[model samples]
Target: MHDAPLLPVSRRQMLATSGAGFGMLGLASVLDQNSVHAAAPVAPAVSVATANPLAAKAPHHTPKAKRVIFLFMNGGPSHVDTFDPKPELAKQAGKKGPGGKWMPTPFKFANQGQSGI
Candidate 1:
């Protein structure tokens, strides 16, 4: 039977494995304190057991919007031409504006969904 040589663990290796656990412990203490303080004077103790430090909670009142979608257009096509089509502006295409001539959108607009806006 061949015996394998054991290598010594470095400081960096030890920290990398255990650093996250230390960070989590620190985070938990901060969250516990914040939850206790954030609760109302009458129900201060309730928050310690009921409050979730990480989970998302609903607002005090029901929100009109259930979900939201954000579009981040960076160094691409124009948003007005692509998503929000202005039919009135299309009619006045090539017309002289206050600054310069109004340029028309190359793409055609078509209704897609039942709630067409």
Candidate 2:
């Protein structure tokens, strides 16, 4: 018989392919009786531990920074009264907030030889 020209697969063409499932496995089992009757005696049974395609593994190295601390204050207190104060902040506290609203300083500042916030 002469070879026929191969036809190209077109976008409009529809395919009807039925896959082999458990029924095909059953058929394979029925038609595979010869495999059970081996001519030579079998060797000792080996463990069937196949390599896992998706298995959990340990990380390569130790991680640092076990904790994260964030202290959020809506309107922070006066700098000088609380911690290291800057005289410039007290000089311009109510003048204008960080976002432009005139937010008064929560606490008072003073001149401790070093100008207070």
Candidate 3:
């Protein structure tokens, strides 16, 4: 048996295959223009003396606290064991619970700061 000869792709076939990519580019441009025009007007920019963006600016209204920092620990230390120490948990350690016996925290906490968490 003889094998059939492979045919080369024509310019029309190539253009047809690539038409979707060109269409997507055109659609993206149109969507971007619509979004730009239809979007809400930007608020007037706050005038700053310094070039640095990190430089602190005066709040519109007086804030109770001057600054705030948020710490997010994903799959980190348990809150009860670390921040909120429970002495009763130590006494009830090794006691059976809903699933298994309760385990005590290894770290010992002490009163430190003036606030004393």
State each model's CA lDDT, in order: 0.80, 0.60, 0.82
Per model, how many backbone clashes are there? 0, 0, 0
The TM-scores, one per candidate, come to 0.33, 0.19, 0.35
Which of candidates 1 and 2 is the stronger one according to lDDT?
1
Per-residue alpha-carbon lDDT of candidate 3 for residues 1-117, written as tens digits (9 for 90 to 100): 999999899999999999999999999988986795666757647645455678788779977996899997789777655777778889999999997998888988788888675
Per-candidate alpha-carbon RMSD to the true structure:
16.0, 20.6, 16.9
Better of 1 and 3 by TM-score: 3
For model 3, how big is the CA root-mean-square deviation? 16.9
> If the candidates were sorted by their TM-score against the true structure, best first, what order would they fall in?
3, 1, 2
Measured by TM-score, the strongest candidate is 3
User: Which lDDT tens digits does candidate 1 get at residues 15-113?
Assistant: 998999999999998897679566554746656436767657667997899799999877887755468877887898899999898887788878888
TM-score of 2: 0.19
- For model 2, the stretches where C-alpha displacement exceeds 4 angstroms are 1-82, 102-104, 108-117
Given candidate 3, what's the lDDT at residue 113?
80
Error of 2 at 22 (Å): 36
**lDDT per residue, candidate 2, 1-117, as tens digits?**
999999886544523222346567788876675576535556637533335535556568876879989988788767545565445775776675668955444765465785432
| Candidate 3: clashing residue pairs, number | 0
